[model samples]
Target chain A: MALTSEKLAEPVAAPALAEDTPSVAIRNLDLAFGSVKVLQNLNLDIRQGEFLVLLGSSGCGKSTLLNCIAGLLDVTGGQIFINERNVTWAEPSERGIGMVFQSYALYPQMSVRGNLSFGLKNQRLPKAEIEERVNRAAGILQIENLLDRKPAALSGGQRQRVAIGRALVRDVDVFLFDEPLSNLDAKLRSELRVEIKRLHQKLSNTMVYVTHDQIEALTLADRIAIMRGGVIQQLDAPQTIYNKPANLYVAGFIGSPSMSFLDAETVESGGTTALQVGARTVPLDGYEGEGPLAPGRKVVFGVRPEHIVVTDAADPAAHVTATVDLDEPMGSDSLLWLDMDGHKLSVRIASDANYAPGSTVGLSFDLSKSSIFDTQSELRL
Target chain B: MTDATATYTGPHGPKPKRRLSPTNIMLYGTLFVVAVYYLLPLYVMIVTSLKGMPEIRLGNVFAPPVEVTFEPWVKAWAEACTGINCDGLSRGFWNSVQILVPSVILSIAVASVNGYALANWKFKGSEVFFTILIFGAFIPYQVMIYPIVILLREAGEGISAVTGTNFRLMGSIWGLVIVHTIFGMPILTLLFRNYFTSVPEELFKAARVDGAGFWGIYFRIMLPMSLPIFVVAIILQVTGIWNDFLFGVIYTKPDTYPMTVQLNNIVNSVQGVKEYNVNMAATLLTGLVPLVIYFVSGKLFVRGIAAGAVKG
Candidate 1:
């Protein structure tokens, strides 16, 4: 083994809270439906002007958490504070927040202008003031030409824009969005994703977005709260969450095609630490320290498909050989299904590097950014 | 580009003239037969009502009258007799109006609110009560009439005992209105409940977040959006209350009889020669209200009742 003197960096914990007052503060909140607890002891603090995303699969309490913050669902226990006021028992409207729904929820009978102005008119605001706010919102959302058209006349993208405009006209400090782009097609979802990012940049209002789409969560969120079974598995910045996940679940869920896990044992030889898989030993020089590494410790080593480099046969670090079983050409990158030591592994490499099937290739593992989970505890170590 | 070449192409490949397919012919033939079957009674009624009494007796029911006259319609509307009163169904017609306008309005108002509550503000035991109410719709009105009558009589008696005024609801239009409202509640509430339930729950949530209260949401959102269902409910109740003979007979005195009861009495009276033309005219007149309502609300009635068949 060639020893490289690389100091293992410490994995960063949760980022420090910003100095500004929190825009929305959720205390030890709990929500239960009869015998089923949907969320338990959940605490989240959203900073002013920050884009926070709550992400999970369906029935994972992400949308339920958004509803609780919006005051659409009554919390069974604990308090919700928006703008430093306890709004736990307040009505959804009085909570000083606006919301956009996945279904758009535009009144079918009303025109786009009517939909945007209905709430303001209900507050008995003056006609000119309502017009001014509505016009500004329509201009901001680029829906001025659609003012007179009913919801049925507009397409899905236009309807969502109107929904966003409805929230915009309210001129509130915080906005809650519940899977607003899930109804759109893939092209429209990406288009609206950018518009929403632009909206956050322009308006600079604190937003709480809920979605199950990991791409949207990664692209749009300043911090992502990955939830599972009503419990938040990890909460951190996108880069940190992507680079150093808190547990095996986060690691598996965050990547497309999922990360590959290999049963390995930590081995130490000549003051060098490494992981042994079958007959090959890979260096652990770049792994960030979670706890003390010891010899003969069992672990499940994980590596993302993109991080497994197909190395030249003559490279000194190339210790493993795999046969390419199949190739999925995805335009810019190709995913190769390989068999290494009787384990199927996916390797995403540049599409131009055409590795034909049935060909043998040498592989080098990038251990610096890999994950190692304790076998017993299933947590990052 | 030459005219002769264009003409040659057009003559060589002329478009085929449109023709109806066998499927279209079969479908239209079935529809025509069904239409005639439904219109037969209406044709007989209209033809019979236009004839003199002698002509109706002389000819078969299907034959159009050789000599038509307006005398039956005039007598039916103004002078036909029910018991000692010769003032005709005009009295009962006006009585129907009095009972109808109030009954329709009151029943729809109460049932809609009840449905709204059952749909959105579901409290404890609400579903139990709504289920019982909907099941009550299947029970025949006759089975429960006696109990309802006794209940109303006792209620009136209780009021009179306290107020010293004999509040007699047994023979009043107000009594008929109350009875109609009670009977109409089950079906109307079901119709409105299903319709309100079909409304996207998100809209209700959006309205709540828009600062709308209970009545505000109802008037501004639910009521406006549910106009079709309301039209359906109105069409239902108007025909039901207008054509009711049994309830009118049991609940009202002879003087306050509705058009249906009065029409029945005038036709079936034992003392006079059977004026078949006059009976047909009176029947046609009594049936006019609902026919008008159905005709006016033609497409909406079809659309409204099918409201919750597909989720929006």
Candidate 2:
């Protein structure tokens, strides 16, 4: 949370874009395979020198949208613009973008150097220039020692570096990566992820990355577009999306040890707004929203595990009393699952604070960091 | 307790297998029988070709020649008669060479490009085209022989009418080469298509994004990685065109008859003294080209065909 908060501060302190033209734009894009619509009327704008990540679970059309932007999949309708040009019908190569695939996709017959230079040779680039570019990309990726080795001789991480170098040698203005690190083990994935972020800082080219991993979306993206069922549910800076999700789905999808919910009804007594959960009345003094909460509205009170605190003293007016059901001790912290009159809720606490089963505890909700959602619309109130 | 301890030994894997186990006996015994069955004819052909005519008449066919002579090989190469020509199988050998080289090259080149296009650069009617081409593979050559003959005859007549010259494919070496090439296309195309299909689609997509068009991708990427399949195609075409007898007899006349047809004529001429040695020598010569090719590239052939068997 501290790391995320620090990153959240820097972008706000920075100035806005000097020019508003997006490096890549999609307008009413639609893609279909025969009768099955994979994407429909989707629109996105990627700013210059920005790293935009399309994040979702599997079959969420995030990869499909990235493919459309890369000019790999032909859109069934609408247009795509790159650098202000209408490149709806342009070939992938002509779109001024370089793409890395999940499988590394290096030519198995060619050495690493050959894999980087094959496309340039096809373009008929001057030999000296091709050599220089290949050398520079190899140096940047730190794969110069592997230049003579074929792809089969390299390990998974080294092969991926070669793949990125292949894209780097193209020297295009935009890069599209499709789960490029998913093939590696966890340690290498994190190492490569940092390198990719460093590469973005050095080159400052627009990048559109597609992945199903939420952590990758959180750490690397300037803006994250969360997609579900061919539609973008939310798009915002990672911190904004994490703290103030626009809908119930976004709130639930963003966090690990996901947010806990309590079924409640809003109450207004003497101009003071509050929520009634079972037998307890929780005050809504610090709850921030677009407008005042209406009385008698059925709503879901959502609070993340880390936002709930367990206290020893039970003050019925301020805290909900619950019995601990189980505690899972993760290395850094433990999640305490509690049963409050048959409603299950989880609270995050330090690993040293072990809670035995059936022990009573008072749970204090952080109202400022919690979300209240309308039951019918599923939107945050 | 003592018996159990005696049998236990230390914890280890199963006992080492006996060399002469029942399974090994059955496997090697069957393989040895099949090997002998296949090699017996070749052994007979070699022994029969080395025997003098007098030795063959006086002894059993299986016996080694009491008097070995190379006269039959020389006669098969220079003195044997086919139809009315005293010239031996050398002329037919040259004709077969001319037909085999062009046909193998043309068929493999065209079919590989066809496979590359069908597998990667798919167009509007590509699947339909592929279905039709694969359909052609199942039709028997015997059923299409007369129709092909008529087609070649008509082509020759049309060319003659246009050029006012005696241009004919009906009795020429080129005619047989075309026939061999056409016959070889279906199976060779299938082999190449299956191989290229197994190449990762991402590699093809990466190449397309890297500014490589069809030929560029083929030569720089697909072609180089496809050496095994190319070797497969070459072996298939070489063997098919080299051993062909029907097309050689039907498409070309005496001056351009292929080695197989010449071998047939020498064996069943119905006029000579039935020189079994000479007949065996001619048969061995006719079969030598494909045998030599198979032996030289035998390992690559297995590797190539096995590429399509298991896909990652």
Candidate 3:
């Protein structure tokens, strides 16, 4: 149970000690079933000890990619490297990765201890060593009391913990999780999510997690790989992916109460760049990008609901007036769906902030925090 | 009791009657009729088997024996003649045991492995063979009996050709076992296949990820979880092979005749005066194995059959 840093580092071979050698490197991966192409030339490099989450909705190849990395799936045309060793044709167990499934696939007929020790027994490990590993895993997961119980007798949370313990006892270099918390209730899911994050912190082992829940992706991933249509849209830190999405799809897909988009035209007035929406022109200040904003370029402007602000005594040059069409009073904040010159936009405010339907309010779009994409390409500009 | 106003009934209230309701009467009445209908034959068999030969001829079958005896049972088991074998059903019973034990084990072993392969490790043309086999089950044995006899004869001739001596299959209990196994294949395979298919795919995948191969997963996970269906298959095969008269008569020599055929020959032989008491005892004895199995496996038989029929 006392898994010190040195003990956890016992499995690393000396040849893999080179700095900058990625823990898992996937190159030009292609997968297909019959005629349907699921993944196409996908490439990724997972750093050592990094928690990388492959995040997307269903049918996006996130789980498929994780399975390929774990050697559970055969890639049609590609090479996979783990710790600088080519393992594209290796067996799943030989790949040195342990997986946790959404169903918590524990052996139903075995006690929790038996389930944890089954693979070790299959490999014919020494009895005392297997016992020590199992006890340590049970202690780490705090499932010592549940060790004697069958899977059917445990609660959902306890079963999932045992499933994690099964992987932990394997003493693998990487852990693959395929929506492990999806089957739990909301309360258990959040609690287990925190525990998983803590586990990652304590072990500092590389983890490749697959999830459709954006909260899990954002909170747990050191780098979140936002995928769409079998391609990695953006791979960056959580805040970077959130604030500066690579494309329109990533921007639209990441947030709850999704970012509102408005049709606009990029125009240059004097020497400053500004976007004109309907009759109002908002200055684009501190818009960090590569090139100058050309005049007369059609674009779509995006803003999160919480970033739009309403103020009566506003800077006349910055504030744009709109009418509140609907007000939704959430417990801590109110979402005001406003009519900005016939374009619908939503603004988030404190729950106690007074605002009524049909009331005229002065709304300001913070251009510094907003995103703009070219209309035709749908790429962030 | 009088202290509680809620429990006290007014004097003017209608008197409560304790007569059975019409629904209860109808339910119990139908159940009693069904029970009598089912038990009537067994009742007659036991009573008739206990009576003296003269007494059975004089009284109705529903009447109990005036002079009770177990002589008919003893004669039926050890002394009754079946085509000059006065050793009675004992030889046939042991022959059936020889056929039943091996047939049940071999049939189930082959069928379960076939089912697991069909359900999990699917190869090209496996399904075609399975489809043909299932359709083969619907064809009556009478249509294929002659071909099977010829096949066995040719197989024996092939061995004779190689070994330079007569190697007979037509007069052996092994031939009858092979027949029962072939006939019992379709339904048993279908039972095991559907049951294994209903197991969660994720569990199988997880086992594979845990370094389990085909036999490993089957022995460690699938086999343990499928005990009920195996019991169901055992029950089906045991009863089917034990009571099989057609295959027993067709495949084996008279020396290796199973209990059902021997019982038929002993009771229905036209040469002697009819002994109703002895006939009833032999019939009961022949039916005893399946009866004991059905009684002991009562609830599990029902559950297993239902489980095999449906998928989750």
Candidate 4:
């Protein structure tokens, strides 16, 4: 990774970006609270200088997993490795990992100067060295002028910066953020997200972040780990998770307006593979969805909301008839709700889509981009 | 003045509405009457104090005096009678200060330590300890006094042996101070516990992640955050101990009696001249510490109690 101040953050496609070495690796991790199991046999690998996002809903054990790695929580089973050294039983400070809590957790009584310098002071560093580190962190977070202000006097974004600066001053090997941007307003979240990315690039620190918003996971994660029910659904580059999702869960979870699903049995109508939805068999051309599928056994067909297109000039064999239930115009794209085979589905159409409530419309799926899933396991077919 | 006054600031450039009608006038007037009723004792005290022995003999208890003098304030300070002693309330005042100062200071500091630990440090049996300690507060002092006396007697003799003299805490100023502190601990600790609990857990977590250990969190974060509550605790503890009669009576030697005990002896002496002026003056003087506290902290009472109860 090269640093160029002239073109600081262009979000360039990384062709030469190495598969960086694992800075953190958790093996066969199990976390439990009394009789309830939260994380069961979880394995994770975070590479050096890589921004890894743990994407999940609340109580899905994303924050718990990060806490285990941060040494703020204990692992009941697995071993945690930071830079190839086992840190399963190590104290938090000894692990050299910095965590930004969801609340920002800035000390209210302490000035920004005091908050950032607290760690160094606790570590019993020399006064001059502490001052130097504080100054450097302040510069990095661009909070030099606000250093004298109390946390109450600072805005959410400024307080968040001070929190980041507190971590930066420690110069830790890994930085863990547990929903850092969740507290900020929409505008501030985006601004701080960019700042965090720049910070990571400049420091080249391996960072593992947790957030519920899929957009955040997509934008900031070099590699996103989509999780469900305390299990990692997929771990891949953002586009890979978007395009070639490993399972039905990942496919549905990654995209906004979500991917739609229908259980249908595979049949051959003419030379093309067709799905028998109730009594009508819909055509699926170039359907090479490769997973276990017994002919006549129910399997699922999936199409993203954006993939469903409505057209006036329709081919009867190629498209299905849909009655629009509701429509939402979202700037460039409009979402249309329609009923098909007793299931209500949403279609993301162009904002100029000449459709209205209760209107009969013809819908087509780009079957080449469609995915099939085994109904029982919900895995990609 | 009360009705027109408003704390609201708005776009109307402060044209505070005058909503005080006849009903409001009657309400305010009745409140003024009630306030004077509470002040009646103080007014009688001042009137009686200004009267001489001759006027007092008339026994017109509510009558204003023809002549006024500052003799009682002077006499109470340096010449009022104690049993077999008319040396005045002046002599016992220093003893009161000595007993009161250390008792208040020591109790407050100890209470803070207990409060911080009970509130923040969640360990095994910590809740049980807190529950039992709070339950201890509900126990009648009279029920526990006998056992406490026995413990003090045994402990005092043991100390006297070690010091090579007939020494004991049974009737010492130190004993009284310790007793006040232990009794005061439950309430003070309760105040501080509630106070510390309301402080955002975020502050504590931030300190810990920044390499703060237990002592670090307490001193650097919890202590600084608990200052307002600490002030209130000190005020409450001071007033409670200063006004304490039974504890001071039972625990202290005659030479070490606090203001309350001395005032009691001078006012309630058997066959003693009922010098209403001196009694009232002494009590008013004795009530002065809490009165001053109430005045100083009156406005901030709500804030001082509920300062950090909610997140900002």
- Please report, in order, the local distance difference test score of every candidate based on alpha carbons: 0.88, 0.88, 0.86, 0.80
Cα RMSD of all models vs. native, in order, equals 5.7, 5.4, 6.6, 7.4
Over 4 Å off, model 4 = A1-21, A74-77, A246-251, A268-274, A278-292, A316-319, B1-22, B63-65, B84-86, B162-167, B308-312
Worst 10 residues of 2 chain B by lDDT: B1-10
Q: For residues A249-319, write the lDDT of model 1, one tens digit per residue.
A: 89889989888888889999668878897777887877885877888989988888988999765677885
Candidate 3 chain B lDDT trough over 10 residues, lowest sum: B1-10
lDDT string for model 1 (B252-306, tens) is 9988998889999998998858888888899999988998898899999998878
Better of 2 and 4 by lDDT: 2
Separate DockQ for every predicted complex: 0.68, 0.74, 0.59, 0.50
lDDT of 3 by residue, A1-381 (tens): 212422332221111222688999887678997689988776778899999999999999999999899887789988899988999999887888888999999999999988999888877899999999999999989999999999999999999999999889999889999999999999999999999999999999999999999999999999998887787887888998788777788899998878888899988876987888877788888776546878899999999998788877355754578888988888888888988767888889989888778888887777677889889877788
Tens-place lDDT per residue, model 4, B1-312, is 655777656666755766788888999999999999998877888889888878988888788988887787777777877776677787677777788899889988888888788777767687788778878789999997878777778888998888889877877887787788888887787787778878666566667678888788888988887778877887778788878989878877777778888999888877857777777778777888789988888656667767634321
C-alpha root-mean-square deviation, candidate 3: 6.6
Query: Which ten contiguous residues of candidate 4 chain A have the minimum total lDDT?
Result: A5-14
Q: How does candidate 3 score on lDDT?
A: 0.86
On TM-score, the candidate that comes out on top is: 2
C-alpha positional error of residue A169 in candidate 1 after TM-score superposition, expressed in Å = 2.0
Worst 10 residues of 3 chain A by lDDT: A9-18
Residue A162 CA error for candidate 4 (Å)?
Answer: 1.0
Query: lDDT (0-100) at residue A112 of candidate 1?
Result: 93
Docking verdict class for candidate 3: medium
DockQ of 2: 0.74
